[model samples]
Target: MKALYFTADKMMELRDIAVPVPKKGQYLIQVKVCGICGSDFEGYMGKTGRRTPPMIMGHEFAGVITEAPEGGKFKKGESVVVFPKPFCGTCEYCKKGLVNVCTSGICMGVLSADGAMCEYVAIDEKYLIPFSPEKLPYDIASMTEPLSVAYRAVYKISDEELQASDHIVVIGAGTIGLLVTAMLSYRKAKHIIVSDTQEFRLETAKKMGAHTVVNPASGDFEEAIKKATDGKKCDFAIEAVGISATAESSLDALKIGGTAIWIGNAQKIVSINMQKIVTTELSVRGSYVYDFDGFKKCVELLQNKVIDVSSMITDTYKLQDGVAAFKALENNTDGKMLKVMLEV
Candidate 1:
């Protein structure tokens, strides 16, 4: 077996390694396609401490089962998408169905756990979700993880609040942001506003169904939002950039008492205006990864063609060209690249 290892800062190496043997209840999957995430880029740059060196770094992946326990629910040769985060079913959060934030949950590829950026990986059977290859291609199926994240973020707001929101702002037109915008559009959001520093991303956002796009680097972002909303500001804002400035922009773009959902996790700590939030009665909610049911729903959405993800995937590369793939994402100054996939 071959694996792409994150050896050091801004470095990746394809090395030969022994295939992993399936654990007690794990299934051996032959990885087909894996998507390079923004967090992988951050780990490559040594920004986020979540990823350590000499570990395979990929979570968004789809594959075919090569080995499975005898008489298991899922048999060998089945196509499946992995849910990266394995939770302890006995945990309090897991018992409450909040598996995304399970107290004893650990995300694969984030730390010591090697991920699916290789020829094969042994994953627990509980984390595998079957998908039809005829309906969902491997490249698109690999996006289930991120799409689930987007779904959870948008659905964090209640159905009443989402339907009543006449104006919604999405900060940062990254993968998650663009996907969030697409989900909102699919739900027929009245007006969708997306902001980013890159015009290319803003253009892509428009293609994803954003009614208004603002480049915060060009001029005043709030002014653009006010103009887009007719000076009423936004009824809801979703922050997907996890930076201090963008996080603050999400809060500032909302009208009094509006809700803001923070989905990005790049930064561990971000400063915001507590006074404004307290005085204006604004609500700030943090949305993590999707629960198990949410992940299954995203797979269903993809299988049924309810949400089109064709536009979100911008580039693909061979698994051996992992270094070039990471480089393309790192040097994406023009922001033409959105989601980069590695074909194993």
Candidate 2:
């Protein structure tokens, strides 16, 4: 089997590896597609500590079942998508059905474990969701993890609040950001404002249903956002850029008594207006990766055509070309490239 691994110096390298067999409660999948995520690039650059050296690097993958143990729900030749999150079911958080925050949770690819970057992977049956390529293509199915993350963020929003048709701002027009905009559009938001420095990504956001797009790099975005909204301010803001500036922008755009959901990982501590939160009653929430239900719903949406995950994939690469693929992602060379897949 061929696998793309993170070397000691934090670069992706293709190498021949041993094929894994299914354990008692696991299934062996013949990997069809694996999408490269922003975190994957960060891990490649040594910014994310979750991915150690000498490990396969991929988590969002879909494929056909090559082997299934006795009594498992999946059988050989069945197509499926993996959750990628390997968590202990015995932790306090897991006991409360919040397994994503389990104390000993380990995400495949990002952790020191063999991931879907290879020709085959032995995954636990509990985290696999069977699907057909007829509903969604293999490359789109590879995006189930990140789509699930965006879905979980929206799932956390209150139902009553969703019905309020409040103005919403999504920072960053990347994969998760675009998906968040689509979800908000489906939720019937009064206005969906997407902000990013890249005009191409902003245009992609418009195609995905953003009512307003702003280039934060052009000028003071807060005033533009305010002017665009007629001084009403966004009722809900989401930070998808995973940086200090975007994180603070999410806070600055929110209306008094509104909610700001930070889905991005802040590499450094970001200053915030805590006084405004105290005076205006603002709510801040941190969203993690998906749980079982979130992944299921993401697949359902993809299957039902409620959202188009396929269009988000703009490029593909073979395992041998992993280095160039990651480099293209880093440089943002292609216009509006949302997701890149590695063909194993």
Number of the top candidate by lDDT?
1
lDDT of 1 by residue, 191-252 (tens): 99999998888998998899999888888888888998999999999999898999999988
Q: For this target, which candidate reaches the highest TM-score against the unseen true structure?
A: 1
Q: lDDT (CA) for every model shown?
A: 0.92, 0.83
Residues forming the 10-long window of minimal summed lDDT in candidate 1: 103-112
Candidate 1 CA-lDDT value: 0.92
Q: Count clashing residue pairs per candidate.
A: 0, 0
lDDT of 2 by residue, 153-253 (tens): 87777878877845889998888898888888777777899999888888889888899999988999999889878998988898886777787788889
Give the runs in model 2 whose Cα sits over 4 Å from its true position: 266-268, 333-335
Candidate 2: 10-residue stretch with minimal lDDT: 329-338
